[model samples]
Target: MNGANHSSGNIIRLLQSASANAALYESGHLQVVRLGNQLFEELSALLEACGELSLIVVENELIIDGRPQEYSLFINRFTALLKARGVEYLKFQKGITRQEVASLVEFLSGAAGEPGEIASTGHLRFGYLTVAAGGPPSDSKGGERCAAEVLKELSLKELDRFTEIYRAVQRRQKLKVSGIADVVSGFVDLFRQEGAPLLILAALRDSDEYTFTHSANVCILNLAQAMALGIEGQQLKDIGVAAMLHDIGKLFVPEEIINKNGKLTDEEFDLIRQHPVRGARYLMDIPGVPRMAAICAYEHHAKFNLAGYPKLPPSWRLNLCSHLTMVSDFFDATRTRRSYREPLELDQITTMMLDMSGTELHPVLTRNFFQMLSDLKTPS
Candidate 1:
């Protein structure tokens, strides 16, 4: 078996043994210690498999190490025990101790009595194994950009909502920023605490769903880049909203053309090119939508070299947010999966972006953007 499968089996065994020990601990402390020692060894084995253990519960689903564990009797029991105590996520690093295992057992046994109790006794942080769930896990510098299950689920849901709202706006209905606002805030909160770089948790983009996923992923990328740029508050929120809705006009184009697996005719290509204007108009008509959003929607397709469609004045300077969104939109588009082709690798994408810096992208912003990506890739 592969290492992941082997490790997953070990995790199942660990959960089973831990749950059993927790249930039996009150009867005999010595027996519990022995069982807990076994559990500690199990964890050590799994830690040796992967660098760390990350457990997440989304509804009834349990995911470990970005892969879902197979469902079985023990998994069901494990889920029930955690839910009964309001525990939703867990993480463990190397060198976990036997005492920590024993404390975890006690916490799980008593946690059921407290409503929404996030952590176990002795004030053990969830990641540290006293076993409670609250806030984002403490971040380790240059760590993998894994996010909480709640945040991943929330981002997906918000993407769905954003797509629906875009359809409504395309139908000439007014846009509501309330749902979008909440999603941006949630993203900001998680980003600040988790320190995860954008696109880390993005789902693979299918051909038909490219617009929706791309919009959402661009927003995530944009938010991270913006945060790195020291942009904050209302401006940050506006940028996120705008980035997510950048391609809203694509909804006006025929789906067949968008999803075509072959080359497009000139007419079809022109219709494809009109999305920026169409999307910008949609946003401009909305009352609460910011002007920057409309401008970004309009100009996201416009080249930094002033060579793209919907030609503007040669001397016109685009908004800073527009420049940022343009880079973000291009990065996400090139990296998106499609029926016609696979997504590009990060090194290739970064190289391509850097090549386009002076004439097709903002030189300074592109430099900073790639630097941030490079920093994220280095081990801390």
Candidate 2:
């Protein structure tokens, strides 16, 4: 390995050891303190050499200083711990102190409070990585791309990653919930920072991209609505994941049936309609998959009046997360170009949603969704 890679790997190993020691012993334990000091010294030297030290966890792998690390047990354990604690990125500035390093180890070890409590201090910073538009810019003009263009590109890249994750679910591979979490984290950060719905929503470039784009858009819309209602942190992240995976059952349906240009026969349509149950069951079986995701997967299509599908009992109360996902799903599906129809304008979709309110959709949530949209449209 090169000098940079070797140094980064060693630092991560030290971090892993320090965190383990912190978890097993008291804060002032000699081993923990010693490891923390060593970690501080090593990280300081590296930060001085490189100006900044960044460790990002992407898809369960570590990306050190923007370069991916070679897979190893230490890398896996360290990244897993970070992800478990909802941290996707860590940045160490040159002036970081030994005390701050010790605190970070404790935080990573779960001995300290939540990740949010220790998000940043002095030279230590940690949070989700913004979903990048792509690799380095092609030329000088690339720096001049407008915010919308950059967001659209980032949305497209996220769509590609989501599609891969969806395919993995279809193949019955272990669901990488971390991948979904990372995508949701990006949306959450975008909402928190930019707070512009239009810029965050992806434009449909091709009909073939609709499935993933629709899910991605729904996630964006759901996060917007959730944040407006004061939902934050892990709950907000769970809602985003649920919205993104609400349509995953469609992966089990045959491609021919899903992409049919003509009207579907009853049999094909029945199969299509069964996706909710299939998706819920699939999600429920996966360990660490949020129960909200399964509930939303099953209930998003069930309608507010309980007249939609799966023939639930009259007393079945839908989950709040499911209600939110339903509103987002309907909005995105109507706004996007489909095989059977062209995309609807905002006004047309608004009218349709208003007409369906309380019967096919939740009355309060639907109105809140539109009111949020109206607020977005109105000038400041």
TM-scores across all candidates? 0.59, 0.59
RMSD of each: 20.3, 13.5
Q: Candidate 2 — which residues are off by over 4 angstroms?
A: 1-157, 202-208, 377-380
In every candidate, how many clashes are there?
3, 0
**Per-model CA lDDT versus the true structure:** 0.68, 0.75
lDDT of 2 by residue, 1-380 (tens): 27767777779899999988888999989998899988988988987886667776645657665344666787888888888888876878788888788778888888434544575887887665432233233332322233445356465567678788888877878688888988888777766555454445533334276777788788888887766554555667888889888988898999999989999999999999999999999899888788889999999889989998777988787777787788988888877777788878888888999999989987867876776665333111
Residue pairs with colliding backbones in model 1 are: 118-132, 118-133, 119-132
The candidate scoring highest on lDDT is 2
Per-residue lDDT of model 1, residues 282-319, tens digit only: 78887888777898888887788888877898876666
Error (Å) of candidate 1 at residue 158 is 3.2
Question: Lowest lDDT 10-mer window, candidate 1?
Answer: 127-136
